[model samples]
Target: MGTYLITGIGRGIGQELTRILLSRGDRVIGTVRDPGQVPAEWEAFVKNGRLELLKLDVRDEASIADAASRVNEPVDVLINNAGIIGPDRQSTLNMDFEGFLDTLRVNTLGPLRVVQAFLPQLRRSPQAKIVTISSRMGSLSYAKSDRIAYRASKAAVNKVMQGLATDLAVDGIAAIAVHPGWVQTDMGGSGADISVQQSAAGLVKLVDRLTLKETGGFFDWQGDAIPF
Candidate 1:
């Protein structure tokens, strides 16, 4: 089984992805901002030898570097799933600048820092896959509506993933940007259309099918390329 590293494992899609990966015999290295936040049920998985949890604050670059150093084994896959959405949900004019910057720190810069810090481990892998969880709302083509901070941050991440895909191509690693769909989670809210399991499963399938040809393209849960 492949070695997988995932962030934001405290809850939602990240937690479900960790569970599914472990069930399929893949080793999971998950990061949670607070170690205490790890669910008790998940502890059994850690105890049984399939999963590992680390305290990681994605907003902190030093923390990212420290965590990256702990992965002694090669990482076949790195899923940048950690992100945040503030509760205000305001329009750009009414949005809080501090809050907007906070979202950008977690959603955009966090993945870039992690990918940079962990490049060594990823380079050592036989088939390296860097999967950044982007969003349709991030699509500049679809930005007739307003989400202000989230939209801008995710859109920036999409570009980051695209550039990385091109730069890392010679190493045979595939860097993919994917929208997980409107998943029912804390961030997606109760009205979202898809369950976390459905989104996670589809994402795993998409990652499995990733090739250098598909790298740098933004995609949805069904693997359809999303317009920039």
Candidate 2:
């Protein structure tokens, strides 16, 4: 029964998370690039007053501010889920510099933009929590060369969220980063290990159990603490 705001509900983990939240009677405010692109199942929830679908591109700060202004109710939870895999040509030797920058804009600064814009709504809620979807590839401990752009972006966001947690501590707001696992989605691909349902379900549980003590910690979908 909490008012949850999520970004990027067009497909993948975001869509599944919206479905699960709605099924449990929680009010969801979901964002998608195109409102027409939303699945039929999600549209049904919209008609029932359980879901509010907004057009938002996380990379655009103006659009995020507009979306936040439209939502009159306090946001109990804000999930920064929109992200991209970056250009395929991204590598250490030959990198698409522009694409790499765009990746960082979306994956790193985007969440911070949304958080700052929605601070008013978040403060209105007694149990405010901010969750950013980061990836294991971002971990500095994992020394992988592939997809350097994506990895760097995620790593930057992890640090950004950590700073946010520190600054928001006195306000009683919890902020944490979570890895949704390698789920079988358009981004995770067919060969991925887990399904959208499994990732989304575990993430919901993690969100429910989030506390001020765990803020700024990086964790997996199952709530296991991940080494930074």
Candidate 3:
């Protein structure tokens, strides 16, 4: 079974991904900002050695480095899922600069930092994949400006993922950004279209079929390509 390292698995999509992976007998190394608050359902997996939880905060470099240092096994897949919705004051005409900066730090740069810290373990894998949980709201082609800070951060991250795909090609490490559809979560709200279960299921399927050919492309939860 392949070993997958997922960030922010305390709840929402990341937590669901962990559930699916662990149920299928795959090893999962999940990261969360608070380890003590992890789900009680996961106690069995943690005791079985099939699941490992690392305390990490995407905004903290020291935490990411410390988490990476603890993982000695090769990670077949790395899912950068930790992100923020950004401050409420995000807008084109008016913005919270500090909050915007924090958004960029977590949503855009956090994944890259985690990848750099975990490169050694990724390289040890026979075939490695890096998946960043991006959003369609970030698409430049969309031309929508609401919540500009969040959009801009996602847009910038999409570019970063493309560059990573290019640079990591020689190493046979596939990196791609995925747009998880609007789902009913704390961020997506109750009015959202899909459920976490559906999104997570599709994401796992898409990630399983990923190859170098699809490394630079952006895709939806259903495996359909999206314009970045």
What TM-scores do the predictions have? 0.96, 0.98, 0.99
Identify the superior model by TM-score, candidate 1 or candidate 2.
2
Q: In candidate 1, list every pair of residues with a backbone clash.
A: none
lDDT of 3 by residue, 27-131 (tens): 999999989867898999999999999999999999999999999989999999999999999988899999999999999999999999999999999899999
- Local lDDT at 46 for model 2: 85
Predictions ranked by lDDT, top down?
Answer: 3, 2, 1
* Candidates 1 and 3 compared by lDDT, better number: 3
Clashing pairs in 2: none
- Judged by lDDT against the true structure, how good is candidate 2? 0.94
**Any residue pairs clashing in model 3, and if so which?**
none
Report the Cα lDDT for residue 59, model 3: 93
Q: Quick one: ranking by TM-score, best first?
A: 3, 2, 1
What overall lDDT goes with each candidate model? 0.89, 0.94, 0.96
For all candidates, the clash counts are 0, 0, 0
Q: Which one wins on lDDT?
A: 3
Give the residue spans of candidate 2 off by over 4 A.
none
RMSD of 1: 1.3
User: What's model 1's TM-score?
Assistant: 0.96
